[model samples]
Target: QKEVEQDPGPLSVPEGAIVSLNCTYSNSAFQYFMWYRQYSRKGPELLMYTYSSGNKEDGRFTAQVDKSSKYISLFIRDSQPSDSATYLCATLPGGTSYGKLTFGQGTILTVHP
Candidate 1:
């Protein structure tokens, strides 16, 4: 099975709604968690990241990690149409395996105005 798994959601929501994205992994070596946002025809950009198990919040975005369960999540508050994009959940094994990120299939989200 793939180390990281996410729902390929063509999820649609109205503007101003709260959005939740989730991913699960089976790899125990993964120590860092990341969420990337990719707009149409563009490379993914790092949206948020967290080390170990915890929650990291920045403005409208929140990233959470749970090591015990090997799960991660991203939450977006006050959604906007511009926020529509493909969001990917990624994990990296720390130490010598640096720079290697395993990504999920990505979930598509559209916030309609």
Candidate 2:
């Protein structure tokens, strides 16, 4: 099984809706979790990161991690058309793979106006 798995959701929602994205991992050694947003034809930009397990929120975006369940989630509130993009979940194992991120299959989101 892949270390990280995410639904490559072509998730569609109307404007102003709350959007939720999730990922699950099989590795317990992962110490850091991150979320990246990529626009069409552009590279992904880091949106959030958390060491271990906890919740972090920025503006309309929120990230949550549960080490016990090996699950993580990202939530976007009051979504907008500008938020249409691919979201990826990533993790750092902090061993020989230092500085490298194992990424999930990206989830695509579209917010319609």
Residue 90 local lDDT, model 2 = 96
Report each candidate's C-alpha RMSD, comma-separated, in the order given: 0.8, 1.3
Check candidate 2 and list the clashing pairs: none
Distance from true location, Cα of 42 in model 1, Å: 0.3
Runs of candidate 2 with Cα error greater than 4 angstroms are: 95-97
* Model 2 vs. true fold: TM: 0.95
Off by over 4 Å in 1: none
lDDT of 1 by residue, 3-78 (tens): 9999998999999999999999998888889999999999999999899999999999999998998889999999
- Candidate 1: residue 105 Cα off by (Å): 0.3
lDDT of 1 at 7: 98
Cα-based lDDT at residue 52, candidate 1: 94
